[model samples]
Target: MMSTRLEPIQIGAPTGRLSDWVIAPMHFNGFAGLPTTRNESVKSPKFSCFGHQWRLLIYPGGDRESSDGCVALGLQNTTKESIEVETKFIIKHPHGGGDIRKGWDKVARLSPKGSAVVGDVGSARGYNNFALRSTLLDYLFDGALIVEVHMRTNKPGQQSAPFVPENPAFQNMLKDFGNEETADVKFEVGGTVESAKGRRKRAKTPTNTFYAHHYALRWNAPTLADMCKPGEVSPTTITNVRPEIFKHLLYYCYGGKIVEGDLQSDAKDIIEAADRFGIVSLKLEAEACYVDTVEVTLDNIVEIVTYADSKNLALLKEHCMDFLSSANKIEAAEKVSFDDIPSHLMKDLMVAFARREGEGSGNGDTLSSMRVSQLRKLAHEKGLSVDGSREMLIDAIKDDEEGGETES
Candidate 1:
């Protein structure tokens, strides 16, 4: 099969929430793996913005008052004196279109105490219910919550729009991209991947071929460019992805957007192909679509979670955990055949199960936060003696699981 390179797109700088006034990013990496009890929170490092010391505190599960659905946020006046400021949070939605909620423009009189936002901890002036977990899951990318805080600042974000000089001649440079008139690059798709380095081993007697310009191809997909070195005249052979899928990827890289219908057809495949080509945006779209559109249930939870963990798709894994938490944990554990799941990911499932049922944090020696009832129930079910303190109960369970003595 042969196809020409797609036309260029008009991609520009981001046009969502402005980041000039305050660019404090709250990066909660591996949020799904670090299971926390509802109301339990983590703090981003203190950042300086608007000539003030500020820190972002996020409750991964939910707010202190209502931990069921809301993921709350808090901003502290780290300086000595109190300050009254209007605030808004722009959740950099993982799936792409940022979730910027209106009417959250809160003007609070924040004080300096034990990282105090209002009168005291859990008092007024803090972000009470910043976002909901159900909605946030769709926003998250790779199980990370990336948020940008914008404050009412004395200075305007920008004095004037930056200038973009245009010359009709610039487009002409790429005009020959799809034209065989001078296209300098060739791609052969569908073959075997080299196991050692994870790159495709050039197929013997390649069949499928595509044409593209060297500069355009190199800029869009570097792996392909690297293979077609500076002076090489041979076609860069690729394997593992279908030629049709490559067309979508190549088109998107050249400034085109993939249609929703194509993503709906084979989002998982697209996600894998996009990731392989270092296409972050497409990967995020497929991931977000799969979690948002696909129905998650006990029957497919194991398969999905396993695939997610393998790909390091934290956002999808988090969504899977949310579904399992809502479903019966006992039944979910039974339906989750440990044999299919890799040894490493089994711990995540157990931790999520324990977190939902017992409100436990991620698995470790720090199982003290887990409710005694949940631990005792698990221990009793394992036919182990449940006569001990919280630490002792944890040790017993850990021993059983580690020793491979516990049943699925």
Candidate 2:
């Protein structure tokens, strides 16, 4: 079992959009209120193209020492290995003005971030001074700044993967996921603390116990490998992870068999667990599963969007928001509770809705085609009626805005 390693994944054929460049456009509304202090950045939701997840990181007030007084922009590679991409950035002008286009873009290579937490920008690469803040602010018409990224992924260079002869005994070990007889390591996941011997103590529950081989975990997960190192005790206790999630993690660690469980309910948890275990490949796999499996409906849109935003699951959030902003669904979405949306996620939604308005029905200056909830929220803020049809609500908000302008 120790010598059983699989062959390199045969890249026989390209997946979706593998042969073409992907044009991703991002719009940030209410840019003035975003943090202006240096390196304080915001990220666009994850997007998938050419079989990889990606994002655009924006440091509104620059990133590093040399980047001060400018906005920094970077393209992040979310695959298991490092990637090089041919990339370009275009700052779009509002109200039919010419776009501020530049070919001068320096993108550093993006590598796999093993066990690095979020906000660690090591997995991304782009210009430190993507745009001068002083001048860049002028492009934010309607408090919105838009960027269009033209990128095509370069084919990964051929690399050698170790091919070891398979052992039947080792292959059989993988079949027994939690078999104590076969597994050399034990783990206790998710238990409560109790007052024992006049002090609080951590104890393991029997149902929560899981078993696995040390070498398999050590080889598959760098974080778990650290635990199996010298000076570490057995029956390792992990309070943060549930037993089911741990079992799933062990399943992937032993072999590469990801159980096609209920992904819609557990996908977020799986993605999170994989990240915690330094399983970059598993994280990517779980993310792809969630992105592909989850269906966002009006009833579930708010909850799904909030989760995606909180996790920075960009592509999932983007897809849900797209479904949410469709003309037929806008009013239906208002019936759901968005009050629970985090401030940051609410901002994302607002920005998305504003963009939809700009592209669909807005005059490029005045607000139009806002969702019913948005209109009611505005009406309430301005001490007006929150009742009526969408059109009536829009009219009331419009009339109030006109009245305020006349008074001013």
Candidate 3:
């Protein structure tokens, strides 16, 4: 039996305005007896289109008793609210690579299945003529049938709204309670009002004291909340964190945006501080900023991966793994010291490398045992230099596998 590789297709997000339509491809395998007199349908994976989840329902045999011989397909709006959608269904021709039917386009009001009956094909008599079971079998690629559905919202003028309301009332509330006049708690960073940059100035640095309402700190940062008492007169001395980074964290707590540029150079420190203070949202934001701005290279991949592992940042670790496995594979293998990588992480990298080369087991015979022709074939497949002695070829292959450039 041949192994069927499931490759995910990349779908680009809509550019300017919200997407008017979404295109999703559904592949159905194990197509035996389908669509009998009973109402039966195969469902596609749920996808987000126009701010709502949707799926495709394909019926090989007619869905209803009236239309038993023909194929039936429908669009289902899985979301709770009623949605207006226009759908176009196209089936690939079994023989030639074109549309079997010209194309079927319909506009309807769609709601959850039980609530309202909408956006269905062949509801009247069922589409019996075009997609027969025998014809679909011929079109199957490796015993799988593929169908494409194009779905667009009927309300083209409506714009997608943000899930959270950006209200000014919360900012007003912060200002009222967070100012020095009303704030009962104080945070002093490094015994100075200014940050590291301010310390370099000729002028004397004053004590860095930020006033905040204890309630705000309690609500935003659970860890910090634990340290604070109801009416403590003495300021909380934070010796570990820099004044500027703490200011950024405070800003986020007060419903202010943390500009990406301000934290670009201090992402690691900020993320660590956020993690320590139990600021989940700020930690996530810092992680995203770090991933977006940091350059991934052979020299830094191991360090970054280790840092991510230490911080328990799953997304950053996954990003680093992806880069090391694909973009900087050869360089990482050659330059990164395996001693620095955790044992479990190294094992994961080995497994990934084997999977990329379609190797069942990572261990294998040396290049010397293989013939010159075989070595040449392997080099050609891997895009490596083939003009070399058996020993030289062996060294080159090993270096390439280890993500190192062959020596001149």
lDDT of 3 by residue, 12-83 (tens): 222342335677877887766444544577777888877777777677765664254566766667777766
| Deviation (Å) of 81 in candidate 3 | 30
lDDT of 2 by residue, 231-334 (tens): 33468877656677777788787674766674456777777777777775676566668878877777777788776665545446556766666647557656
Overall local distance difference test of candidate 1: 0.66
Regions of candidate 3 where Cα sits further than 4 Å from its true position: 1-167, 192-205, 327-331, 347-408
Task: Report model 1's TM-score to 2 decimal places.
Answer: 0.41
lDDT of 1 by residue, 1-408 (tens): 998997454222124423344456677787665545777778888777656688778786766685476777777666765554567777765556756553344344556545533335322245556767667777766778677767764233332446787875545654554565566777778776343336666645456677776676566666656667543478788777777778787766666667988888878878888777766657767887887788887887777877877666655765776676678759877887757766664455565567667764544555544555466678879977554444466789888888885454
Better of 1 and 2 by lDDT: 2
Give the backbone clash total of model 2: 3
Q: Is candidate 2 or candidate 3 better by TM-score?
A: 3
Estimate the overall C-alpha local distance difference test score of candidate 2.
Answer: 0.67
Clashes of each: 6, 3, 5
Backbone clash tally (model 3): 5
Please identify which of the two predictions, 1 or 3, would achieve the higher lDDT against the true structure.
3
How much does candidate 2 score in TM-score? Answer: 0.36
Q: Lowest-scoring 10 consecutive residues by lDDT in candidate 2?
A: 10-19
Runs of candidate 1 with Cα error greater than 4 angstroms are 1-177, 191-207, 217-219, 346-408
